[model samples]
Target: MSYVLCLHRWVGRQALYERYGLEPGMQIRAICTAESAQSLPEDRLASISTLESLDDATAVIAEAQRLIELHGVPHRVVALNEGDLLNAAAIRERWGVPGDPCAWIERFRDKLTMLEVAARQAAIAILPAVSAEDPQAVQRLLAEHGYPLVLKPRCGTASRGVRILRQAQDLRLLQAPHAEPMMVQAFCAAPILHVDGWWDGERIVVLTASRYVNSCADFGPDSALGSIELDADEHERAIAEQVAALLAVFAGQREIVFHLELFDDGQTLRFLEIGARVGGAEIPFLWREVRDIDLVGIAWELQTEACSRQRDHARTRSRDGRPLHGERGAWVIGRRESPLRTELGTLYWAQEALPAGVPSGVYEGARTRLRLRSFDRPALVRDVERIFEHLAQTWSASA
Candidate 1:
């Protein structure tokens, strides 16, 4: 019997059972932090085994090893935890499963190292960016890059600490050694787009490429979203090629499912950064919705490549699934000043009834998904405005 033990379940992976056909029998265990374990549904409640600390490599891996001994080493072990990628990579290697190279994963996560490696690759077009602790180095970047540069953590997801510095004061305040290491970039004037997919040791299986609409200077915080069509224009094609080439260099001798970001001017597309694992909640969920393919499932199959041919066939069948007409999008509702709640209300609205005739009302709470028909733009604006008015601003920090 084949088993897949997931290291964490918060990244929409609980849907794995329904979406990927993993029944209780196929899943040996779900290992996650105790707090995260609480978030699982009752049905998922059965197979979970909580770990005290996912941050401690020795303890987490040892717990995982113990689980493997009791439940038997799974056919695959994967991590959704950003901090646990290295651990997952090592565990996959020890268990003799196909996984991304630890060294390459490191390069992918470390923004400084990623830029350095991509600079050597002829195909990639990563902007010249720098991460520094020195005050003078920070000042030099401000002068060289000029105003309206981006400041973000070297290793971050979802545009968490990302910001645009428009002044010398902003640079000085952000440059200090406060918490996470920060990367400063010459803010390129371009529309941001996300391209997500897997690398089968050779080629990048381009999944879904979509445009991102940011509410503020950075892509993070409260932002509305829209889906753009997939077109491999010369600039976009070059961007993908550049990303593929950089993945090969960073990966060296392993396979990976990379979630990459790009900056596209109408004329050219530039590489932003790459995440070594699956992207956040919406992309993976929405991509499968659009393509009828499961990236996580492919990742698992990639781990057991003896059936590479079969897996490849499955991928072709899944990837060939027709794209949906119109578009689907995800949006986050938060204010620049407010204590944003985490729960996304309820999923009671129908997709066909949005953006046009929907009533405007504030559903107070966390972020909620409201589906809209292509022709429902007016209704969407009205409803969103109603919701916006009821929301009062409060000082708080959130993603």
Candidate 2:
């Protein structure tokens, strides 16, 4: 039998075990944080090991060694959490497992490195970015990119510690300083669109583009934000091609799940950043519910190489054999103060809520979240505008 070791600090454990548990000739062993141990399925308890913290690579390696002693060496080691990707890469390197190396993964984790790779290798346009610690470098970036800059943690997640320097006064926040490394980028006033899908070593197997109704900078604790799936139009197709090229430059030969964010500046698309794992927020849910595909499950399959299924499984067609990528599908996330009540009414609360995975709770400290989906393009657009209008009204009222 082949042994597979799965590591997860906060997310994707249940789904990982549920999918890998029943596969023939595979014995799945999961190592997760102590707090998440209880949440692991009771039936799958025997194969799970709880640790104080997965952030410690030593503890994880020790656990992996124990698993190796009991069973044979694991053929594959996996982690679903974005933060754990590096730790997982370290373990894979130690175990001589088949996966992307640490250096390759770092290109995606580090903001500065990602920009360099995108600009140099992929020939993609990126905003001027620099380390926030150096005073001279900061000034250079300001001089080149001008004001209205964006500052974020070099390795931040979920929009935490992200700030917008709209005016000269905002630069004061940078003066006080912090120990953690940060990056400053030129702020673009373009609508943000995210592309989520799988990238085989050679091609983009499946891809979907979503336009964010509200920019991340505008999102707040109670902000109403959503993304609508777009038809695979010419613009979307070009974006996908660009993303595939960038991934080819980053991963080389590794197959991985990719969530890429870009700025659609009317005339052209500019690079934002990319995540090697599945997209956060309602992206995975949208893939499963709206498109009838288990994106996370497919990612797991790619990691373990346990399944021989082709990417064709995720391809879609209408009753008349027309490609369905042009069809309408969307997901909207709203808070209690959102227009879902005033506009969507009962239809808003009718939809089911997805489990808050890993970095639980909403990004930007949202208190409550309501998610809804629709296949009607016009209806999706109308409802999205209503949500955005409600957000604008709420912001103005607070101001």
Candidate 3:
């Protein structure tokens, strides 16, 4: 029997099974971390295994081999987190799967490679960058880019391991020993912008543009980070076009869900970095609650489409089983979303990224998270500000 095997890393049934697990005559197995397994609905899965951590590619592959022996090769191997991409790629290779996420995943993960590819293919203006491979890499980059340079891991998320050099004295942070490979970028003084949407293999059909209230790199126990979806503006169309152009370079006008970040200095939009998966934080919730779009589900569906051609069956009920947010007949759509649901919004005070023994929140280490929506744009903005005012500012600095 063919079963879909998920390297499930998310906690709670809400992530994978809440919307799709009830389907009759469908088989889905999952390998999850012990923490995630606690909340995952065991009654639905064909069988489930546990892992201490998903990063151990070798251990996960051994589990895959054993699972294969029991259930045959999965129709597709699913991994939704960025850290899980390479592990999933390895599993796909071992199973002789058709998809090769590894081919372009580097462009998505490695910041240096990601910038080079974007510049070469889309004619996008990318910030000058150098790899932090050599011990003298920072010294060289400082000489070239000058002060106020930014250094971050080539493959990182949640703004972890990011460092900014405001003065010459900051060089110590770079010269000090480190394990994670880093990249140096000439810092741009501008508002950080992000464009998120789903691609239908032709053009960008569904997208929302937002400018960060505070930079993603600013997240900390003391800082509050969030993004507000931009209202209709003259530059919106132009920005979407640029994002579409860059995505076309990597995807070749093919199906993909993307989270793209760029720097806009009121004139030119500079490419920062992009991810093949959905945007983290409250983006998925914002898309669903505010836009009547299931962005995370769209991302999940793209993977199934990636590994197979079957179109009808899906984990979540995609609208009409057609281009989800594409222009097709009035966007009759979910039409205005219903009254705000309590379960729809959450505030994550802590996460695994924090030190052990502290309390844990929903999933990621979002000190404060909420998804608000209103047909009136002005009211939505007010609601966001209202919640922000009441949230506690101090969080544990276990990060």
Candidates' C-alpha lDDT: 0.57, 0.69, 0.64
- Model 1 residue 35 lDDT score: 52
Candidate maximizing lDDT: 2
Model 3 lDDT per residue over 1-399, tens place: 567677777653325454442224556688878776766666667888998777677889999999998878887777777777777777788778645457667778888888878876554578888876664766777787789988788887767789987997886776677767888789998899888877677777667777776677775555556666666556777787777788877778567778989899878888988988777666665555434566666666666653221123221323322223321110000111122223322222222233343223222434334444544555545655544443322122222
What's the TM-score of each model vs. the native? Answer: 0.69, 0.82, 0.80
TM for candidate 3 is 0.80
**Ranking of models by lDDT:** 2, 3, 1
Which of the predicted structures, 1 or 3, would earn the higher lDDT when compared with the native?
3
Q: What would the per-residue lDDT of candidate 2 be over residues 1-399, giving only the tens digit for each residue?
A: 676787865532225356442356566678986656645555543488888777667888888889888877778887766767888788789778997678877877888888888876544577888887776888888888788899898877666688989887888877766656888889888998988877767777777878888765566655656778776567666776677777788666777778888898767778888889887666776666566666677677777777734244664422121225454455555444433347562133323343343334343124334445655666778866776676667767776
Candidate 1 residue 182 C-alpha distance from true site, Å = 3.0
Quality of model 2 by C-alpha lDDT = 0.69
Question: What tens-digit string does per-residue lDDT give for candidate 1 at 1-399?
Answer: 566666763522323643344434554467776655654454633377776666667877887788778767776666754566788888887877665657757787878887887777776467767765655766687777678878878876555677778876786656455567887777787787777777666766654565655422342235433333344345545566666677777665566666777777765667787776666545555555544556655655555342354346436643322233334333334323232243223222322223332222121111433332222434434444443443322222222
Q: Score residue 361 of candidate 2 by CA lDDT.
A: 36
Better of 1 and 3 by TM-score: 3
> Sorted by TM-score, highest first, which candidate order results?
2, 3, 1
- The candidate, 1 or 2, that scores higher on TM-score is 2
Clashing pairs in 2: none
Q: Which ranges of candidate 1 are over 4 A from the true structure?
A: 1-5, 11-27, 33-47, 51-62, 65-76, 81-83, 90-98, 174-177, 215-227, 230-243, 251-254, 304-314, 318-366, 371-399
